[model samples]
Target: MGNVQLSLALSGYDHTRDLVEGRVATPGIDLVAIQLSIEEIFYRVAKFRDFDVAEFSFAKYVAMKDQDVNDITAIPVFPSRAFRQSSIYIRAGSPLRSPEDLREKRVGVPEWAQTASVWTRSWLHHEVGVRIQEIDWVQAGVSSPGRQEKVPLKIPVGVNYSSAPDRSLTEMLLDGTLDAVLSAHPPEPFKRGTGEIVQLFGDGGREEEAAYYQTTGLYPLMHVVTIKQDVLDAHPWVAGNLLAAFDRSKQNSLDRLADLNASRFPVPWLRDHLKDVERLFGGDPFPYGVEANRATVGKFLQFSYEQGVAARQLEVDDLFAPQTLSAYTL
Candidate 1:
């Protein structure tokens, strides 16, 4: 029989580029990789199940899984990993000097259940000594108006959350209506290097490094690759096949980046930065599979449960396809 055909939706990340470009192939399956923006992929996949396989928010996926919804299952292929220490933004000279200053202040988020916001809140609660209930939370789009929460949230008691469909978080922060904003994407003004907005953690690279040293040695997982449950049920072997292909694709990307003879990226000292990453995170900074990412996965589950995003704490096995829990050794 010919290979099974499946549609895969994902972001245009360097690690996923090889798969999209056909440098990597999924055995026993023909992957139709469609590159998309993070917002489009997550919204379509989570809300509508639009693709056979897609990248998903770690927080939203766990929340859906906890709700007993079985529309999809994920592999351990994390296409995106980012440290959220730099995600918190504030007015250029707001009184909010530290994460602690956010308590009892109005802080806006694109969505309460946003994966980056979840990690930011986890840091504030555990590291910065600010409980979520202490803040008056506002939800809105980062730059544009009228963005809504993609998943139903079980907001903990005493937490005040209001939706501002008419105003964007950037506008609110600029107008002094919001003390700060925790967003996955920077506000438009900030992206353009406008001095009006600035990151909460000044010197983001240094702070993120310190945060990494304090907690798990992870940049934090933002998105994971998921397969529709019906697709998995019909072609059970597709799970492992996709996992192996993704792992290989990521490795190929890394090999390309590590080649010193020619710079793979536009940045000067790209090779040196790569070496530093390898020194800090080892050979495969972004390893796939449940075991390789156990600490990060476990920590995120803990944060999700503690923050009331997930109905209950989900185990690694509970979230990933069983076949992807372990890899066959040589």
Candidate 2:
């Protein structure tokens, strides 16, 4: 038999490697690596025609809307360490101290085309009373369609960091090139730096909003992995098997929570945040049992309609393959 093909999109999270490694150890699985941001996930879902299984972050789902794909079985939302809550970082020396203080201020963001940006901007408008149109937006990252692709509209005032290494933005934040940096959540290193958070862009306030976004009319966060429908049909069991393995791996990671805390990633400071590291174990990381997946599907469909991202309202029941929900729930 040939290898079991599996593709995953990732945020460069620490637990992501653990999940992929578990799949590789399985009897029949060939994991394909695609490092993607949440914005890219939407494009891949819209354009790609081949993929067996896709792992996604909750934010990515919120951005793309799950109904964009028809054969998703069970999508488990993993806790991204960076996106635990909404917060914006500004240089310690900057005069602006609140979200309301950011009128026409040049703000740095990884991707303006993403749902997190939308959610963040929405919060700034409704909660903070900051008009998004007035904010000088800086879009960072390589391959950002907003700037690099250049649609008819002028690109937002932002630097595309797709070409720069991951750590470059942190440097920019420190040097004062960026007035404030907005991410899903600031990494521990960013927090350790002299930068101060201006405002958390959500209704629940800083402490409670992260969990609230997961359940409310909030869109799924950006996730990177996806495969085309044809590949899944050809593979038959690959999609289900991968989700099962990831669910097992997620469980294993939680059971050995201490080990995960000690495990290292590219960033040492990120690994040192024990309290944050331990948070993934707090709730059902794999919240999408059949019912939850259905609920997410409904939410994504509603998001698409309300956001004008999609033309037709797709049913959550028809989105994933038959029995995918039942089989992957556990």
Candidate 3:
């Protein structure tokens, strides 16, 4: 039989470069990689089922499974992961001292079920001692107005929640209507360095994020690679093939990222930064697999459930394709 030609929509991520660029090929598969913004890919895949395989929001993936939509099955490959503490921004010169100070203050979220918001709130409640219900949560776009929750939510009772349909989160924050904004992207004012918004964790939150990792051991995950259930059913071998190819692809990027001799990526002090990352992660900066990330997965799902991002707490076993979950022997 010829290779399974499939449409794969994903954000342009360095880690998945090899797979997308044909350097690392998935066995028995002819992947047509569609590069787009993460938001666009996610919305198209979730709303329209536009691709055979796609990068999907981790929160939305879990929520889909929780709600029993069951159209897509994931592999253990996480294409996007980041420490989100730096995403929380407060108006410059605000009296808010720390995340704990967010208690009872209005906080804006791009979406209640946004994966970044989930991880940020988890860190706030679990590490910073700020409970979810103590903060008044407003849903709005970061730069534009009228952003809606892409995934339906069963908002937990007693959680102060509302919406700002006509204004952006950064707008509300600047207007004093919101004390802070927890967003995946820095507010436009913050990006422009207008002295209007500042991250609660300072500069890039590297120090604060390092502390968060020390406490939680979680380099929080944001996106997962998913294949349509119909595609998987028709080609049961696709899951394992994609998983192996993705790992190789990640290694390819890591090799380039850690290159000390020549500049593969355009980052100054790349070697120094790589050494720091290696030291922090104990040499395994980004391991891709269900078992390798069990604790992180559990913590994320637990937070997802508590925050109503997912309908219920989902197990690691329940989240991925069975073929990718464990090793098989001849």
Q: Best lDDT goes to which candidate?
A: 3
How big is the positional error of residue 239 in model 1, measured in Å on the Cα after superposition?
0.6
Candidate 1 residue-wise lDDT, 172-261, digit = tens: 999999999999999998899978999887786465655564566766889998999999898988999888888888888888887888
Better of 1 and 2 by lDDT: 1
> Model 3 off-target regions past 4 Å?
328-330
Estimate, for each residue in 1-330, the C-alpha lDDT of model 3 and write its tens digit. 899999999888888888999999788999999999988998898899999999999998899899998889999989889999888899889998777889889999999888999999998888888999999999999899988888889999889898889999888899999998998978989899898888886666888999988877899999999999999999999999999999999998888887878999887998898888888889676788889988899989999999998877788899999998897679
Local distance difference test scores for all models: 0.87, 0.50, 0.89
Candidate 1's C-alpha runs over 4 A off are: none
Better of 2 and 3 by lDDT: 3
What's model 3's TM-score? 0.96
Give candidate 1's TM-score: 0.96
- Per-residue error (Å), model 2, residue 97: 2.6
RMSD of each: 1.4, 7.4, 1.4
Q: In candidate 2, which residue ranges exceed 4 Å CA deviation? A: 1-3, 7-19, 23-86, 103-108, 125-179, 184-220, 258-282, 293-323, 328-330
RMSD of 3: 1.4
Ranking of predictions according to TM-score: 3, 1, 2
